[model samples]
Target: MKTYQDQIGNVLGLKKTPLRIVSLVPSQTELLVDLGLKDSIVGITKFCIHPSSLRKEKTIVGGTKTINTEKIKTLQPDIILCNKEENTKEIVEACLKIAPTHVSDIFTIDDVIELINQYGEIFDCVSKSSEILDDLTNKLTNFQQFIKGEKTIKVAYFIWKNPWMVAGNTTFINHLLELNNFENVFRDKERYPEVDITKRSSVDAILLSSEPYPFKEKHILELQKKLPNVKVILVDGEMFSWYGSRLLKAFEYFKTLRNSI
Candidate 1:
């Protein structure tokens, strides 16, 4: 058996390329399919909706934070994919008992690329992984060029409501927000934190995400009243947060978003 170390530095022994794959992370699930491993994917979480038909085709163990271990055990996967932030330690320990588990910890695009490369190594899909890396690097370069001269927009990105949480430091969403030249007002804070935006008078705009809470036009209108001087717009949550093959489209979406702003 060959030993492989994950992003978090945990090592697992694999006899061969993982043929029966179970992905617990939604973004990784999409990346696996894109890297030409769709046929090998036998299980996924309910949130893995990128391919749309994947949920119907694959057995869903459960959601990101919560999973059905019994369902996962029954699937009897050759390997399981997970993410540090998305899955709990309990989940990792649980999966490790069943099969070799690869956990990725990503806070930036570079980390995402490394994860892709690691997947290529373990799954033996080097060509496809290289293709994706090339495309992603090119798109990222184009975006950097486009955003070079753009004015930095001071914005607060909202991911949820009812307590009102915003993406802050050390998050994938914050990384993308910074790339879009949007200065997160909550940058000094760590992780997703609940805040009273009305107190943040320096914020120039408020961005409501379309997922994790599905902020809509009505919510935008509501915030507009509270922050009449500040611009409030609905942003695609996937484009800003998903750190996988979805990033292929994210760069293009960033171009559009900056233009609209």
Candidate 2:
């Protein structure tokens, strides 16, 4: 038996390769499936919808924040995958009781690369992980070069409406914005918070993400009416939030988006 420690300090001890698995985070769950762990995955949250086929076959334990512990216990997974920010502490504690759990906490690209390497090692798919990481790194480098010396565009990324929440400093979206050479106007705020429209006039662009609330083109038109000078764009939420293999294409999408702007 060997014990494997992930970047987040969770130990995965197994006598043999884990045959039964459960995933809590939607992005990581999709990554597991992408890594060819489909048959091995016995349980997933209702929100893990990347591979639509898994929705019917895999048992739904619950949502990301609220998990059904009893249903998960019945499935009897040998390994459970979770995220530090997505799942609650109580859910991780409960899953630990049923199986060896690996928790991932990722913020920046470096952290994402580390997680990809660690996942590869854990799943005995080191080559695949390396390939994905290399591709992502190269693409990110190209994106950086493409945007080098470009004028910094001050932007505000809105994730929610009604209360009008904007992505702030330290968030993944903010990091992605910086990568694209766009300065987040709400960086002064500690985290995502409801923002007042009066303060948003200083930004040159307003980006509405297609998640958390599914902001659409109509939303952009609505925002344009409010802030006539600022350009409103509908951005993909997954490319900004999904910190897995999905990042491989995120840079290209960002480049196209930048061209549009």
Candidate 3:
């Protein structure tokens, strides 16, 4: 058996490359497919909609926070992919009972690269993964060049409504904002925090994300009324938050966004 340690230091003993794989994380599911493991992935959560075809062909165990244990058991996967922030401890423990589980804890671009490398080894697709990493590295380099001398705009990125949550420090979204040269107003706070929009009078712009809560044009207009002078724009949540093969396109998106602003 081959022994591998995941990002969180959990050791996995694989008899062979995982054939019947189940992915609980949406971004990781896309990465697996990009690594040429689409057929190998037998199951996924309902949120794994990158390939689109996977939803039709693959068995969906359930949502990210909730899982159908019976459905997962029925799939009889050799390996299960999960994320520390995305999946509950209970789900991880339960998955371990069925097969070797690899849980990734990603906070930065470096961590994403490491996860890709780990997947390469885990799925025996080193060349394909390396190609992806190379492409991502090149794109990020270009973006860095593109953002040089760009004015740093103070921004607040809203991920959810109702309670009004903003992506704060120690998040992948914050890291992306930093890369884009945008100063996050919530940088002092940790994780996603409930924001008092009225108190945040210093922000130059309000970015409404297109996921988790699906912030739309109507929401943007409403927020615009709340902060009339501030620029309120609808941002693609996937480009800002997804830390996988999706990152291949994120830098390019960032370039365009920054250029517009």
Candidate 4:
């Protein structure tokens, strides 16, 4: 057995190399595959669709928030991976009964790097982890340089509708928005807050995200009707919110997004 510490300061003891793994977090699941643990991963959430073939090859344990503990236990996972924000405390407790669970809490890019590094040690994929980290670092540096002189735009990034919610402070989406030189109009609020755009007077643009709520073009017209003067655009939510291997391509996407704006 080997000892491992998760990002949230939880310590777990894992059977060496964890041949059978269950991943509940979509982004972390993709990172596990990129770190060369694809075949070792015995189960994953239905939302882990990155490789596209993963669901066919691995057992679907459940969604990020709603996990099937019985299904996960049946997989005989030696280790289980989770994210603090993505999974509930109940899910974590249930997984602990089935296998050693490593829960990650990430806000910034540095947290992602550290999580990848820890995965490398636990899964014995040091070289692959280093390669991913190096690529992420270089891309981040390039993006920083690319966005250096760009004007910061005040924007409201919407993650949901009906009630109409948007990303606020202390979230990964907010962190990426700052990185992209897009100042969040709701930066003062906490987490994802429901808002009345009619009341928000300082927004320069309105970005509708493609996930959590999957904002459509028609929705653009709806929001535009409310905030006629504001620019409303549909954005890929994965680019701004997904951490791990996806970030390798995200920097390039950010550059294109900024150019278009």
Instruction: For candidate 2, list the clashing residue pairs, or say none.
Output: none
The residue-level lDDT of candidate 1 at 69 comes to 91
lDDT of 3 by residue, 41-91 (tens): 999999999988889999999999999989999999999999999999999
Regions of model 4 farther than 4 Å from truth: none
Candidates' lDDT values, in order? 0.93, 0.86, 0.92, 0.91
TM-scores of the candidates in the order shown? 0.98, 0.94, 0.98, 0.98
Clashing pairs in 1: none
Model 1 Cα displacement at 6 (Å)? 0.8
C-alpha positional error of residue 199 in candidate 3 after TM-score superposition, expressed in Å: 0.6
- After superposition, candidate 1 runs with Cα above 4 Å error: none
Best-to-worst order by lDDT is: 1, 3, 4, 2
Which stretches in model 3 have alpha-carbon errors above 4 Å?
none
TM for candidate 2 is 0.94
Candidate 3 lDDT at 260 equals: 77
Model 4 RMSD in angstroms? 0.9
Models, CA RMSD each: 0.8, 1.5, 0.8, 0.9
Query: Among all windows of ten consecutive residues in candidate 3, which has the lowest summed lDDT?
Result: 252-261
